[model samples]
Target chain A: MDFAEICEEKFDINRYLGLLCHPGCGGTSVFMGTSRCTSKISDKTVKALDYTAYVPMAVKKLKDVCVNARRTCAVGNIVVAHRVGYVPVGEPGLFVGVSAPHRQAAIQCMDLTITAIKAGVPVWKEEVYEDDTRAWTTNAECFWLPKPPTHSTDLPQK
Target chain B: MDFAEICEEKFDINRYLGLLCHPGCGGTSVFMGTSRCTSKISDKTVKALDYTAYVPMAVKKLKDVCVNARRTCAVGNIVVAHRVGYVPVGEPGLFVGVSAPHRQAAIQCMDLTITAIKAGVPVWKEEVYEDDTRAWTTNAECFWLPKPPTHSTDLPQK
Candidate 1:
């Protein structure tokens, strides 16, 4: 599922949940992105924030991730939603859900889905500080690097 | 979130969504395992199956995956659930959810979570065929092999 809407309303976990469920699926994975109260540059505590997306492109990217995941993994249903406009601290900025037939596939698909969103989607956010300061931030560095294997003996036993 | 109960209920998508909703996270990964109607042995269509688990041990293993995921990755929540008793063809067999601050971490944790479940959980399944034939199956062979790198210059991504 791909949704692009300007929501100033409260983040609805139930709505996110509803979109992620599929009877045919046995596993579901999700990710939620929230605003941090502290800024890395000024170290100012943030009170609120505003998020915006290049709606058409963002939606296309979201759809692309879902489609790619479905093709790559044994996944069933998927949902991705991002909150636009003003959001308060502790509020979710983005949400992604993936459902599949097996737990492992679901987890793997979810990882790929979220990664695709971050690397490809054109979404931007502005931090609104408690002192009425605000600045736009780009998601250019939101890349994920895979972890090194912990043990050589932990290799896949196929 | 932790749950302990038994009911004749359909799958719950919200719980899975909850697993993904972590504010510090940029990605969420998941895996789902389903019941296939075809058997690997005879390639015959399956009818139903009975699942049994050493409840306490299974729960312990599930919790262990969650704990390990949190420690190893910047994940928000991890969820794993398996069905017991009988399940029909095309039905859901298990659920696993993981949420992390980054897509790579989420994917890594989810992969490990599912792998641990298969290796350590005491859950078992007995397949029932249309001809009243029955046989037990283990998930040992379901372990996946990492795909070879697509390009000579490409380093391993997952």
Candidate 2:
């Protein structure tokens, strides 16, 4: 069976892995997206990440991706989860796992599932910097439009 | 730094994931090999899998693979662990995790690291079947040699 959820609670990697296990499957592959201590865009130290998602739409999209993965790969069980609200550095923000009879299929399913979610899900992230600067950043995987400027030139320079 | 070990204790997915987390890395990918309830060869019901590894040799080989992965992929942190002894069905036997600034490198590193271990490490597994049959099985990823017979059938079937 497939499982998908958008939770406000902490993401449990083991619990999800357990749910993905099957009697006939020997391999499980996982992808974890964490709130890193450093920002990829500005190289500034990051404190935490605040996530907001269109709950109903995001959950439906996650479930749809899990179903699609089963048809595309030889997957036995699949899990996809994203955490909303505040996530501290080194904590997991999103998780995806896949189990299959073979290693290749499990690996392929996990890779594809994560890519689909990043590209299609309506989840948004705001990086909370150590310097108290917060801005909505663009996910590199979502290459649809350019992000708006964080600071306006009309403001006085520091 | 990289970490690799041949452990006798149960595999902890979260601990290894934590080791792979770094301030500069935003993405982590993992591959976990578990003990399945069914055998891939005979389709027999399996209860558990007993693993044995030449610790010194296996650890050395694992470390070497980790180093090679660093040179190949744009990875920041890497962790590989294999559990020796009995691993129950749906429990993890082996785990590999890699973290990188981007998703592509993390995924590639995990994929290659697991492949290398299955092919080169001096680890062995004996499948314990529900019917009390025990036999050494070949890892599906190790595509090199043919496995020896578990029992000789010199006489007629019982």
Clashes of each: 24, 0
lDDT digits (tens) for residues B3-120 of candidate 2? 9999988876667777888877778898889899887666678899989887998999999999998999998899999999989888889989999888889999899998899988
The clash tally of candidate 2 reads: 0
Tens-place lDDT per residue, model 2, A32-73, is 888888765566688898898889999999999998888899
Query: Highest lDDT, which number?
Result: 2
CAPRI-style class, candidate 1: incorrect
Model 1 ranges with Cα > 4 A deviation: A1-29, A36-42, A46-49, A64-78, A88-91, A98-109, A130-132, A141-158, B1-28, B36-49, B87-93, B128-134, B141-158
Tell me the whole-model lDDT of each prediction, alpha carbons only. 0.63, 0.84
lDDT of 1 by residue, A1-158 (tens): 44433345666766765566565455566666666565654566777668766677777777777777778887667787777789876567777767665666766676677667777776767777777767665455565423222332213356
> After superposing candidate 2, which stretches have Cα over 4 Å from the reference?
A143-158, B140-158
TM-score of each: 0.65, 0.90
Model 1 lDDT vs. the true structure? 0.63
lDDT of 2 at A69: 81
